[model samples]
Target chain A: MAKGTILSIDAMGGDAAPGVVVDGLAALLADRADISVLLHGNEPVLAPLVAAQKALAGRCQIIHSDTVITSDMKPSQALRRGKGSSMWNAVEAVKNGEAGAAVSAGNTGALMAISMLILRKMEGVHRPAMTALWPTLRGRTVVLDVGANLEADAAQLVTFAIMGEAYARAALGIAKPTIGILNIGSEEMKGHDEVREAHEWLRAAKLDIDYRGFVEGDDISKGAVDVVVTDGFTGNVALKAGEGVARMLGSRMREALTASLMTKIGAALAMAGLKTLRSQMDPSNVNGGVLLGLGGVSVKSHGGTDARGFARACELAADLASSHYRDEILANLARIREGGLAAE
Target chain B: MAKGTILSIDAMGGDAAPGVVVDGLAALLADRADISVLLHGNEPVLAPLVAAQKALAGRCQIIHSDTVITSDMKPSQALRRGKGSSMWNAVEAVKNGEAGAAVSAGNTGALMAISMLILRKMEGVHRPAMTALWPTLRGRTVVLDVGANLEADAAQLVTFAIMGEAYARAALGIAKPTIGILNIGSEEMKGHDEVREAHEWLRAAKLDIDYRGFVEGDDISKGAVDVVVTDGFTGNVALKAGEGVARMLGSRMREALTASLMTKIGAALAMAGLKTLRSQMDPSNVNGGVLLGLGGVSVKSHGGTDARGFARACELAADLASSHYRDEILANLARIREGGLAAE
Candidate 1:
């Protein structure tokens, strides 16, 4: 685990898997100079591809996986009959200490199911929450659970805060990440019972981290906080809704630029600045979604992303693995328990 | 109702209360030749404002109101002590058939509470849903339960679909709107119990509405379906998240355009197209949120919007009141009852 260089990869997972996976691994190795891979997928499909990647010469090894998980497979179905699958083996590698982190772009539900089954939740952690790094106006914000479980109680929300806060610290190198619950309004009594209870708990708990009061959905991208916590159901919808609107606006902008020759010339003259804006809003730039609260880091790349995006996921995994965020989470939870807000 | 020309105005609500209200009413009256206003608030504050509006000379009346509902007031509090407030008086005008509809830019929770308490729920309706008109790539999509109540059961979702469908038909003028339930994934068993049950009921029920199976969050602004249905919590989050991202991107684009002298010149040359894009994403263009399932048409404008936005809300109020959307809802409910999916 030196520098957290080794990563387990589900090479047969995403829309253009195996190819993008190998290419992404090669890209990561070239970029990081201190990374290796435990590539898991069909041997015949991946071996030649990995052999062709010059960067994979000494740093990568193919771990043959007999089964491939489809995008439509149910999590329950994955749990019962998904042993030896590429996603399963990838996560198992992390569990066995062969790799510090696992990366996949497979079926989200199935991935979460297999991930939880293989890399069980950490001690005192109620459930594993999916993580999304939202690029805000200020910088980047960490939002969870984008889709882990359907609902969360007040206690579970507290766990999300600990994990999410640690992620902001570890991944973004923030000193003391500000945390807020995602509610309909900043008002204490705006949301349901669960969010209110969690808000109260966070406010009352004597934790080392900074606990900002409630934030609304619009606060996610405005960088109102470093970490925004919410149940998976609401988080997933928010993430996707933000994504959809971004894409819509991006398309509209593109159309506007192309609508006339003058605007097209304007776009050309302003290419550098516009490109900066585009990169800032690119999904690939923020492709990795860390599955938090698990025993090992598991980064889920966007399924439709290319090698560049997957490489970003690998970078995120390496960052999370090498950082002291996990230790921070343990300490925060201990603080909560000490404050009598969480069970020992 | 004379083509729904008459609207009751809450002159003492919103961030800039009587000023914006009167100005927006004046704007709407100037735009639409047939419209009239029953302006309700402190007559002393509104009298001079109305006198200043040239459009209000022949077609406006100020009704005195003793109370003004503040944005910080809770729904329960609004219900108990809000009877003679401007919002209450405005909605009462609709209930008493003095106006075709009521328009208010006020506290959403308080507005919903007061509207329901005074206007009451329509026959066979479980709860009122706050509607948001999402500007999609294709045109627009009607999303419901933006925040009337939090959670909804399958029966309530069916009602949302019905009301959302009728809203699309009435406001957007779609003949038969396609409907979808928002979920994490598009699969049948992808989401929580409530969404799944609602999907199943929508699929099974015999209705004239086009029932698409399921839509993910990204499909909302993509116009994958004409109407999207979900619990209020999810809907509210989605709406705000979309708004947040749009605003963030907008700010970023502005920054990028002004980053360099060349880009500034390019932006100046491309100002017209960018303005079109800005108007397309403007909050004022989509300001109104219809409180459906109430006995009378009551539209809630964005609390922070300007006079232009309030005017847009008034237009939506007029549209809903004039159209046969309510009868369509009643018919759809009757159809659901006949199909044995809902209670009589």
Candidate 2:
């Protein structure tokens, strides 16, 4: 069992709330014997669910809270009236050093707002970024700033590269991760002013990163590099667009498989192979979005995701918690700072 | 026969130029009895190929051009020395009123630069945007500003919405096409200042377009609206990222179908249905990138696309030439200016 890595959970958050949360916790505990969780919600509702799951019984600790943060609540509303709420307490556990990380499937903006307020940004970290593991032809690539902020300046982009390199190590276990900043073209003079400026700084900074300069959007699927850095607006759009295409193809494939009796029989015959493809292609399998450059480890799962997805988010958070991810980022930032590189 | 809409072809451009160009012209001629072409390239090289095609024998007129613009040449360099080049001659045909539209499967930057110089921007247009028809769940949606210019301010974004609406009417045959500006969220208050400002102008402007407030990235796949408007940088990234995910899913699907003997047999049984699905998903079928806000119609085919893809580009150009696409945009822009809306 992995010792001293307890994850705090917002049990009353997400679309399927307490049910999926408890079920996901059970599923996670079943796979990993070393982990434990501090479950935050109304204990009256969650206590029974925990008791029912044999794997979750002794490994879970329920923290009672009166109110729950609704998914539709604005970030401002969440921060103002969210004291003693289930979601707030879950993150409070991480700030208090009672848990290695906090896992939430609640409102994304709320989670980001709350995390920033409670844990604070890591020392020297300008702004936090939302990082997600993008599945590629080879494996998974870490992509950052998936809607954390609207714009990222050249200096902030360089910071993203430094943090993304550390993220790659924690999430994918790549020793020296190759990083690429997302742009329209790979040429040195291509793209907006900030990206070009970011490129030069990263190339000259001599940071502890294998910076591969600029890469286009297609590089994400090609898995041409390990880490992809971009501003939040572009990153968010690209991320969602990728998801949109994946869903479209999946739907089309289903229609094709059931078009005729012969095709139906064929689908049955090829069920195993199809299942293998489906497993990897499903967004639920890759549900975790890690909030990087934070003082503590924080993973946000999709609100609409199911138990399997929530469990996957937990696993990703566990990976970050157990590694020296934060330390590596600090060290990398120091190198850039000491060199006086990526100056605004 | 649909008459009076002849397309000028850049026969010496693209990755498989002369071969794909002649073949694509033949394909386009075979499909539409109303269309003719002024095939521009080295007469010695193109004349023999055109002779072989029954469709091209009478309808095609060869225009000799000694120079061919290489795909890697920069836009500025192309502008300086691309005189009498095949690409330049094709657009020249449009300017001389010899052809209704110009079709090029060449270096995108060079083609855009050449077209801008020859046809020039339409009256009251700030900047011309590159538009493409995206395959959606319903039929098609027009997405614009795909890497024409990096930054689009509030006014530029609003201009895109105006141009995109007209482009949809031409390309997709949707009268009063429902339009949307792409953003991270559908909420009016979400996203950057430019998008939010553009959204207000579009919703309040009361132009000919049926302006739907805001759309997310996934809305493209969902076919939620007729046209999606965005800045060059965001649109370009979204377009390529969507393509990347589609290609990734396609490769994975192929792997699944051939994974085992049983799966291969299953794939064979479902071949017809799968082909139907493949036909719709194939990028070649929807290949043209129409340069909107230009005085004349110009459609850019993918440089790496095949003969079928080139033919599709010609067909899209033909659609624009035959319709009042340019007039609609001019009228719409005039309305915005008269109202004193979308002020910087």
TM-scores for chain B, in order? 0.96, 0.97
What are the clashing pairs of model 2? Answer: A2-A34
> What is residue B316's positional error in candidate 2, in angstroms?
1.1
Off by over 4 Å in 2: A186-189, A342-344, B1-3, B186-189, B342-344
In model 1, the clashing pairs are none
Which digits, one per residue and each the tens of the lDDT, describe model 1 over residues B1-344? 23437999899889998898888988998889778889889988889999998987878888899999999888888888999989999999999999989988988878887888889999889888889999999999999988777789889998999999999999898998999999996233488888898889888888888999778889998999999999988998899989899889999999999999999989888877888898888889988999899899999898888999999999999898888889989998998888888842
> For this target, which candidate reaches the highest DockQ against the unseen true structure?
2
- lDDT accuracy of residue A274 in candidate 1: 99
**Cα RMSD of predicted structure 1:** 2.6
State how far residue A73 of model 2 sits from its true place (Å).
0.4
Give the native contact fraction of candidate 1.
0.71
Report model 1's TM-score to 2 decimal places.
0.94
Give lDDT: candidate 2, residue A29: 92
**Each prediction's whole-model lDDT (CA):** 0.88, 0.88
